[model samples]
Target chain A: MWEYLNHKNGNVLAVKNLRGKNKEEFNYSQLNKKITKASKGFFNLGLRRGEVVALISENSPRWLIADQAIMRIGAINAVRGCNSPAIEIEYIIQHSKSVGLIIESRSVWEKLSIKNQIVENLKFLIVLEDESFGDFLGWNTFLEIGNKNTSEQYEELIDKCSADDVATILYTSGTTGKPKGVPLSHANLLHQITNLACIADPKPGTSVLSVLPIWHSYERSAEYFFFSCGCSQFYTIPKFLKDDIKQIRPTVMATVPRLWEAIYDGFFGALKKMPKFKRNLIRLLIRNSSTYKKNLRKIRNIDLYETSFISKLISLFLVIKSLPLHYLASLLLWPNILKQLCGKNLKFPINGGGALPEHVDLFFESLGVNVLVGYGLTETSPVLTCRRTWCNVRGSSGQPLPFTEVKIIDENNSILKYREIGRIFVRGPQVFEGYLDNTQASLEVLSIEGWFDTGDLGFLIPNGSLVITGRAKDTIVLSSGENIEPNPLEIEILSSNFISQVQLLGQDQKNLSALIVPNMELIENKFAEKNLLEMNQDFEIKKYFKSANKLFIKK
Target chain B: MKLKNTLSQQINYLLKNRSGSRLEEQIIDLIFVEPFSLENNLLTQTLKQKRKEIEKKYDCEIKEMYKKQIKGEIII
Candidate 1:
């Protein structure tokens, strides 16, 4: 987009490279030139306005460059992370009927089942990182095509591109479904650009650490928002997140719930290596501060569940009693801990794309970290409600964005009263027009009046903050007619330190059973003294089953 | 009308190539209805189909689909 090139200070670093081999960084003006050349290159390659381009790549600066290039030429791109199953990428490319493809690398492209067939069908192919393979163009050669031949036609086309024009199609292959293309228009994305300031409100040169996959709507919109505000984004993967946090000293970060759990686990890991007295002292201070913070929140009515008047009165007394401890921890202890953990610059962190585990939310809050959680689906341009920094209510995704109306409705389509849980129906400018090609699916979710059923169950508190309960469609219905939301149960199972992942079964059966992936390292290490690893070598599963049985019963 | 038939033919070809017999995969019978509306109970306010309502409304047509399993015709 021309707007991606239009930041006030073009000299400020825009995209920092942690994934790159050389650790390159690009200023706004440099980013602008790459976009310009790439857009021209794409145009010279016969990619006309409104044509579809399948851009499959993982996290890298080139991904952003390719994306802006496609967009600037008034063409739409169907994006997916190349790490996703090759079949899924094939489905997206074929179903989207793309004219061209901008692939990540040769090694990645080799994974596609029928690469030659796909290449033969497309008008052109450009590999982002590798040498031009056979007839495919490399990133440099493609850019040179535009460099040698000057053209101002792409700029004119950008001016002609309307807000209603479909910008990108992101395939949302949710847990158990076929990939459906969600076509988001320019207007849908622009809504976030203008509106995200209400919660983020970061100054122009804010340092942002990006960890989530940018192909998803949540992270893509965040990238667009941060880019618009001229924030410097340091890109990294989950493996390097802890190191990058210290290295970048980011003032802002966007995250998902699982990453928070990992960080919390790492914190305890570091504490284990400290001197016993100092560790014990730090633990006591953490406990004191947690108690103080929770009590203060109870007084201010920022709790997950209800507390009686007497409890609130007791909380008031506890708040007063803990004042000294709170002050000691806040003034002396936490600043150092925060600096070590979040690099002394974490002003506010954002969480979206999934519900943050309650314990993780409280852990950061206790440390005086402002973790703002937002909620929406991919179809809605992914942000309907977000907790504001100034007026955050713990456990609730805060108020709706400006002009966004969120309604909790029952199966009968009647709006539920406040605090009554139901499916969330949202009507907003950010909501997409329709899914590409699949008219039946589009009609199923989006009403004629523009309301989109989010398929998520949530209730609104009196303060207009939304507390999400669970997924409405993801519920397990038993033969006995009992309904159970499996997400919370799965989360409960996942809380066991030795269990890595769990999925609840028995959708139409009498009882439930779970398929779990054990945290093998922890189990083997802890059970090593018992000769468990040596004994389990023959039938490894039996050992885990026995361990799970022992651990499950104990819990 | 021609474009609709062509689109239908394209879809039928895709289905046939994936799996199944020609008779089973081809577009033998179809109907066009107006876009689902909230005014009728066919569509929910958020536009999801009321399955029971749609079944109730089109009971005869659904029965006809079962009966027509033995035969094929192209109305166009």
Candidate 2:
């Protein structure tokens, strides 16, 4: 990673942080110097090679500097989100045997200071901000200590680091049981940087918006890849995301499905608030553009929708007839609107961490925005398969990355054929070493031959793209012994405009049922328009269910 | 007026139009509440629903809904 930084021009910006009216830019040359100084400072603090260090912070340029510095000294970092529960943070510190900690704020220090006995192995604490509470060392103060060290010492430490050295231990955000630590080596991460560079081909000096939690492997690996390409990254908080997009005009971004959902809602919600005639005009244009793209895909032999031959023929004829109008709409209406919504400079946006609704995918694609949805777990260095720029399918997770092998298997451990939904497993150079200090747990998911069971239920299409159905553990078995995956059902139900979220529940029951959370704003507005002044909760729920059935039964 | 009763009644009404086998005739019982929120301990930090936590928290309401379904009072 540091090799790419060394060759960049001194004037070229590497990272920018927007603070109110002021923007802070750290160029590559300056960042390289700071990283070296920080590494030396850590060395002065008795942080030896092969010891573990913990990082608790939000996304910032300093966060990357601290992480790179730790890696420079051949130390492993155990990163946790700043918002993690106090208990989980303490548990990670003790479990990883982290010798030092680099925290964002004094509040985080307070949270960990209470459990000092459990974290007695922690010898040093470097607080990023200057706010002092206890025995914590300030960030600048710590760096000044390293200034005394000779440059030869820093070079020696970097030379001692090897590609096979364990670099970081990333803890999974446990949704089921206790969080497990996934230890990844430098080679494991470096492989992704090289592979992704070949696949994505991100140009040097491209601007990337850093939004997702940096602690998560999906975002972390992408950050390392972007930095390796010498791209300038801009960090923003959730509240300032919209404003920052306009100002930064980033060429690339990586985010989760929830953030995409919010953008979808915001776009359509704003459309609905427009005047009636204007609203209808934009909606018509959007529908035409969506159809144009779908028909174009079919014409190009990338058929995603299921339809009869006769219907497809008719659709093709219609598409040919409306080619003029489609071109007009695409050229005139969408480009500016998309730019206003998400910056005009966006080359492509990557979505991961969860399944993106197909409708949401279509909505963005219609506006000429390239939204690539990938799938992977933390154990696979986070990205095993991602949609390529040219071969993006609407509903399927894109083809596996080059050199990665993906296969599906049944409960009997036999490989399943294409289109058969089963447990997904992967083997690749990017796979992590194993869970830290948890051999029994690691053995449960990993086979002797090296395939890691992803614990996700999915199947490959005839074209080799994977479609995830749901999680294996989340499956509900009815009393009659029929197994059902709830994710697809829940996603289908959520497509209704009146529904906000849904969870299916029917374990050991006669039939599956769902807990629905209605979009109260839409319901209340509709009721008010109907002059139903005294509407009750029962009436609102019934109205929502009636609308939901129209979408659900069709599926 | 309870949220559970209102949701159960609504679900029962919605399933009345289904035309399927006897097994499919099983009416769905629901207990509506506010959205699952992270602050409420019903959702994880990643925004996934914490199933065990939610099931345990609403144990009483779930039992009442099951009893009402058994009595055939929830079906239209």
Candidate 3:
């Protein structure tokens, strides 16, 4: 990363701030300088190799600077978004044994409210913003400390960082009602950086808009890969996504499925309000193009669940029949739809974090934008498989990477053949060492034979494209791409006196719902003993229906 | 009805305390069903709730809840 940064000496934009009204841009040289000074600043604060610093931040220029600076000084970082649950953040800090904390702001710190309790041996704290942070270092003050000193053997520190050294620790919502820290080494990340270039292959100095939380392994790996290729990255929030897409005219972008869903839903809502004729025309064009694309995918042998020769012949006939209208849609209507959806230059937008909803997938691609879908967990540096241009299957997370091996196994731990649904396991250089300080948890997923169970149920097509079916584990993924580990929520709810047993549901749904068994004894006591009402099972069940509806309406 | 409101009150309190979170983990609605036991496949032999089985069994009820929501039939 340092070498690539040094090589790109020209005045090209490396990183830019796209938040509302905050215009900040840094070229490669300037970014290099900020990171170098920050590294010196970390050094001045007595941070050294193998020391862990916890970064609780969102997407910002300083975050990129701090991330590179921490790595440059031969230290490891444990990163989580500022919006994470306070207990989850505290667990990461406590478990990682982080010495220094680089927080997002004073409010994030205050929200944690657990200053020295979790981090008992804490040394220092740095706030990312420029506020009157009393008794703690502010961003500018920390940089000033760096500016005052640079005589240390920083080059030696860089040389000491080997491929096997742990780079970052990311916490994932484990099935065990706690977040598990996945420690990724430099080699694990580099495998992503080096091999992911084949996915998009963004040109140097081209624009790549980022909207995901920068600390997330998916976003972080994309940032590293794009920045290494010298692509300018602009960070934007979800609220400003549409405006930023038009303004930045990004050629490449990487984001979560939720953002894509938002864009699709936004277009859906807007189309409903459009004039009747215009809406009809747009729908017709989209239908024609989507049909052509779908048949073309089958003809190209990229369509999953359909492999018969008759299907291919039918697809071929349909593709030829629909080609002219499809071409017209692509030429006239699609260009405008693509421009409105992701901008004219969005050639290679990748979506990850969870399965892209089929509607959202076909919706975007119907507009002439090829949205690539990738698959992996944080333990594999977040990307084990990705759909490419040639192998762009509608419902599959393309083949494994160059050195990555993916297979499916049944309940008995036997490998399954193609198209057989089972748990997915991966073996690759990008796979992490293990869970931090939790060998038992690590042993549960990882095998001595070098395969790591992904805990996800999937099957490989004959062409080796991976289709994720469902989860073998307990994590519920909402349609918005948020992963909710139901165990903790169930445990918290079970403590309520009114509930006996609970199972949180909402896989691919908008919000979470639950199957609950009421505590009949407590409920009957509360109503009958209070003389408010006579307890009867049928009447109580009717009231339960009413209460459930009322609760939902309150949402 | 009282049992459901009591649980919602507690959950609402939890959500209130966690205001600035990106996505509030609120249980939009819940269904009152028979207790999950070993006999019902909704609970494992070891007594862990079989979430997938529960979801599959209550699929119609869950969808009805969401449909009720969309139709503005649920009153607060």
Candidate 4:
């Protein structure tokens, strides 16, 4: 990491952090110097190699610097989400045996301090962007201490570090039980960076907008890979996501499914507010573009849509007959419109963190935005497979990355053939070493041969693309012995504009049921427009669901 | 809009169009609440629903609603 930073020329900007309406930029050399000084400071504080240092902070340029600093000194950096509860943070510190902590603010420190004491291994605390409160050391003061140590000392420490050494321990969000520490070695992370370099092929000076939580493995590894490629990254909050996208016009961005859904919702929401004529025109344009792409897919032999034989025959006839209209709509009208909406230079946006609804995938692609949906867990350096720019297939998680081996296995531990849905197990150099000091938990998922059971159910297509079905634990089993994967069903249900969130439930029951959260604003407006606002809410909801049921049955 | 009424109406609407006997028997009852969140402990940080916890919390209400439905009473 340091070598790449040092070799970069022309004072290239590495990271930019949005501050109010302004932005702060850090060049490659400046950030490299900061990492070195921070590393020296850690050494000056008598912090030794293999010691765990806790980093509790929001996503920022300094967060990456501190993470790299820890790696430089061969110490393990235990990163926890800033929004995590105080108890969970304390548990991670104690569990990982973290001797030092690098926090973002004094308020976060006070929150963690409220709990009863148990972190005996905690020797020092360094607060960034805040004044020293109590025994906490401020960021500048800590850096000043490192100024006393020579540059030679920092170089010596870096030389002693090895690729196999534990670099960071990222704690999972603990959906089921206690959050377990996933310790990723330097080699594990390096493999991802090298593999990502070839896969993403991000050119130097390419702009990447970082929005996901940096503490998470998915974002962390991607950030490292982007930085190694010499791409400049801009950090923005959710409130400014729209503004940032327009102004920065990033070439690449990473996001989650919820954000994609929100963007889709927001776009249509604005469209609904437009004048009747303009709205109808936009809708017509979208329909034309969607049809053009669908026809193009059929011509290209990538047709995944379901249609009757007669319908397909008619569509083919219509497509061949109206080639000029398709060309004009797809080439002339849609590209410029979508380019204006998502940024002029936007290549492809990567979606991870959760399953993206297939409708959302089609909606964006129809507008000429390439959406790359990926799949991985925190235990597997976060990304095992992702859709490439060239070979993107909608409704699939794309192909396994280079050097990563993915297989589907049944309950009896038998490997399944292609297109067979089973538990996904992965074996790769990018896989984490083990959970921090939790041998039993590690042994449960990881085999002696290094295959880690992802607990996610998926199948590999004959073309090597992966399609995730649902989680093994989240599957619903009916009393009639029928097992149902709810994710696909829920995703389909969520495609209804009236529905915002849903969870399917019916384990050991006769039939599957769902708990749904309706989009109240849209539903109320729809009811009002029909002069049915005075009716009971129950009746209105019934009508809305009936409409959605028709849609489901039709699909 | 009242959550319970909306939920009950939506549940009935969803079940009404189905033609199977199991479709009627499958969804026993519907209980509505505000959206789930991490603060409410109904959702995890990763945004997954905690099904076991939700079931445990609403066990009594679900059973009582089913009983009311059996008694031909409008529960919502």
Winning model by TM-score: 3
Which portions of model 1 miss their true places by more than 4 Å? Answer: A1-7, A150-155, A174-177, A305-309, A475-555, B1-76
What tens-digit string does per-residue lDDT give for candidate 2 at A1-555? Answer: 575567665556888877422255788888888898888888888887899999988777778889999999999999987776676687788888999988888787676545657546677888775554576788778888879856566678778999999989998754222468999999889888888864466777899988877888888999999888888888887688888888888888988776776677678778868999999998887787788778777765555544567777877886887677768877888778877777888886887777677778888888888788787778888898887778887777788987899999999989998789899999998987679999998999899888998888888876678888766677664533333555545554565555577677765455667677777766555555543323355567656556646645564
Docking class of 2: incorrect
**Model 4: per-residue Cα lDDT over A1-555, one tens digit each:** 665666864387899998422245788888888887887888888777899998999887777777888888899999975666676777787888888988888777777753336435567888877878777898789889878856565577777889999989988755222578999998989888888764577788899988878887888888988888889999998778888888889888888776776677677777878899989987876766667666665554444434566766777876675566656766777676655566767785888877676667778877778888787878889889998777776778888888999989998989998778899999998898788788998998899898998887888777688888766677564433233455545555565566677766765344456666777766665565554433366566657556646755665
How close is chain A of candidate 2 to the true chain A, as a TM-score? 0.84
Steric clash pairs (candidate 3): none
* Model 2: TM-score for chain B: 0.59
Clashing pairs in 1: none
Kept native contacts, fraction for each prediction: 0.00, 0.26, 0.54, 0.16
Question: What are the per-residue Cα lDDT tens digits for candidate 1 across A368-448?
Answer: 897998887788788889999877888898989988998999989898998898989899999998888999999999999
Query: Which wins on DockQ, candidate 1 or candidate 4?
Result: 4
Residue A46's lDDT within candidate 1 is 83
* Candidate 2: stretches off by over 4 Å: A19-23, A150-154, A175-177, A305-312, A475-555, B3-76
Name the better of 2 and 4 by DockQ.
2
Model number with the top lDDT: 3
Candidate models: Cα lDDT each: 0.74, 0.75, 0.81, 0.74
Candidate 1 CAPRI category? incorrect
Q: What C-alpha lDDT, on a 0 to 100 scale, does residue A271 get in candidate 3?
A: 88
Candidate 3 regions with alpha-carbon error over 4 angstroms:
A20-22, A116-120, A149-152, A174-178, A519-555, B1-23, B63-76
